[model samples]
Target: MSVVSDTIDWFSDSTHWSGDDGVPHRLVQHLGYTSLTIAIAAAVAIPIGLWIGHTGRLRGLAVVSSGALRALPTLGVLTYASLYTGIGIKAAIFTLVLLAIPPLLAGAYAGLESVDRQTIDAARSIGMTEWQILTKVEVPLALPLIVGGFRSSTLQVVATATVAAYIPGPGGLGRYLIDGLALRDYPQVVAGSVVVIVLALVLDGIFVLLQRLALRNRPAPVRSTV
Candidate 1:
């Protein structure tokens, strides 16, 4: 109860809402980090995944590799990268990119593989080239799962970005949590946690909408009238 009361007080304080170190600024910083890292991971991972899926070669390798990558500890990578890169947003971004890649890769390949073989054969029978079959058939169908993977990756990255505050530079909302802990300001720490949770929920909602839109735009199946 005391912690809740302190959190409310911390939020009520106007000073916490305004300044370079305020919630809004930190939120933006966190979003920037997340967006860039995910973008890079997507660019690198999706194409490779798609290619592997389309070719039907080395797919087991891709899956196993993604699983291994996902098992990596984010903080350990962050710490190691910071040691070599000397602690900054760059190192944090690098660590996050590594963390973000596996899901995106897995999603892409899974989405591609999930497409029905009959559909691919139908496309081929219709004189559709390999590229057309992929773009027009497989990709469209796989979109939901692909987006699901992206959503998962985004959520993970957003949560992890908070840890960037522990590095020696300006950080996101995690700053509030880290600083509050160092100073024993429990209220501030709680407030920071609430903010992070809210951000994750909001981002997740956006992705849900995106996934729905993708599904909604998907072409309806052709049915035969008896």
Candidate 2:
């Protein structure tokens, strides 16, 4: 059992292999982080998106920015954030937050824009306060779209969290990927890849369920057929 043979054997037996300390622990830790990023992005994006949709200002900026963010690769943004923020989940979160902004903005804008002009006028005619119009009419009408945006953002964040391993800290499943690539361990690479993809799908599935619940609770929108 030469060194190469030993490493090859280790790679072949995944059950016996521990590629980078505690990879399972890292995966859990990164999952927590991905959750936080979703919260933060939603907090920041929802309001901005709401305001943009409600007031109808700087929508072009939101449109351009979110579209651009979508085109940007997770690795590219991770690299940029790592340069500024050092590494770890901070960079991952920052990158994800940017990724998150576009959908929220688009959803919020679309939601608010979807509000009927006549309904707005009607609300005004009855002496409904501006705040009332916003909280009651605008937000409620736009709720579905807003939730969809969040659901979309959550899925994106879940996937992007895997990239955080490139920064440092635990490494999540990505650490295996990074280490496996370096050591030429295909088993670890395949395993890590499988874990990340499966987890991403599972997380997105939960968000979809929640989104459906939200849609169900919202009032059926009123519209004139004429």
Candidate 3:
């Protein structure tokens, strides 16, 4: 097909692989956006989720808020934020962080909650402090789920970071989509999409390995004779 051949030609072009507009540079920019978004979202959401799970307070609030956030249209939010913030990476990151929070928040609380209540009781019964029980028993058991949340958040951010190119600043594989559409160069668009897909897959594979690693060392469940 012409499309396939054109895409191949596009990739074979050395110009696309070098300079500021190159694939490697765009990928690094995309990664910077994703890393910053995840870091900020985790810092904000994980603590709140942990508190809700640990104290049994505010679970209702977390549910409602996370659901509301998940329902937001990401591009619409980015557009509004860009308008408010003057069109730059700040607006893009704010939108991406908001997009990433629900999963991270859900994962944190759900992970903590998934820990056997009996195990927590056992830890408490042994004269362990609340902090120690959370740190030693609950957190270790909950890590897999928490990491699952991070995995989900990371993928979502990587996909959405492409949209960041729409605002005239920030560069990522999305530039291929935006620029390709403008120039009607379908081959570049397809190439960009392929690269984004590959990046996401690679990141996901890494997380899968991390999940297995977390599971391997997870603490054994505690049984209580209530």
Candidate 4:
């Protein structure tokens, strides 16, 4: 109860709202990190995934690489990058982009693979070029899953962007955790955690809405009439 009260008090403190280190500033910093990470990861992963799926080549490589990437610890990667490249926002973004890639890659390839092969053949039969088949047929159909990838990647990036605080650079809500722990201010830590959780949930809800919107416009499966 005391901890809860302290957390509430921390929120009630107006001073926490206006400075460079305030919640709003930190939130923007976090968003910037997440946005950049996601953009880079998507750019790197999506095209490779698309090509692999379209060509039916390197499927094994994609699978192995995604698993390997997923298994790597973000902090370990950050530490290594910081040591080799020097601690800064670049190292932090690089770590997060790595973290974001696996899912986006998986999402792209898996979404493409989910398309019925016969559909592609039919498009081919209709004289649609390979690019047209992909852009018009495969991509639109795969949007829900692709958005799902973005959804997963965004959540992961948001949660992990806090690690930037440890890199001696801009931080998100994680600053609260790091600063609070160092000062033995558990309430601030709790408050920071609460904010991150809320941010994650809000982002998740937006993705869910996007998924629904995607599904609503998706073409329905054809059925044969007896």
Q: For each candidate, how many residue pairs have backbone atoms clashing (under 3 Å)?
A: 0, 0, 0, 0
Write one digit per residue (lDDT tens) for candidate 1, span 1-226. Answer: 8999889988899998888878898899889889999999999999998898788889889878877888988878888888888967888999889888888888888888878899999999989999999899998888887888899999999998888778777488889888989999889999999999999999999988988887796665421100
Tens digit per residue, CA lDDT, model 2, 103-205: 7777777888888889888998999998899998888776767777777776677666666677775356677778778899776676667677888788768
Residue 193 C-alpha lDDT in model 4: 90
What lDDT would each prediction earn against the true structure?
0.86, 0.73, 0.89, 0.86
TM-score ranking, high to low: 3, 4, 1, 2
Candidate 4 segments exceeding 4 Å error: 219-226
Angstrom error at residue 225, model 3: 29
Query: Alpha-carbon error at 168 in model 2, in Å?
Result: 2.1
**Model 4 over residues 1-226: C-alpha lDDT tens digits?**
8999999999999988988878898889888889989999999999998898788899999999889999999999988888877856888989999999998998888888888899999999999999999899998887788888899999999988876677777577889988888899898999989999999999999998998887885566422100
- Report lDDT (Cα) of residue 153, candidate 1: 93
Give all TM-scores, in the order shown.
0.93, 0.79, 0.95, 0.95
lDDT of 3 by residue, 1-226 (tens): 9999999999999999999999999999889889999999999999998888898898999999989999999889989999989966888899999999999998888888889899999999999999999899988888888898999999999998888788888788899999998999999999999999999999999998998788895566422100
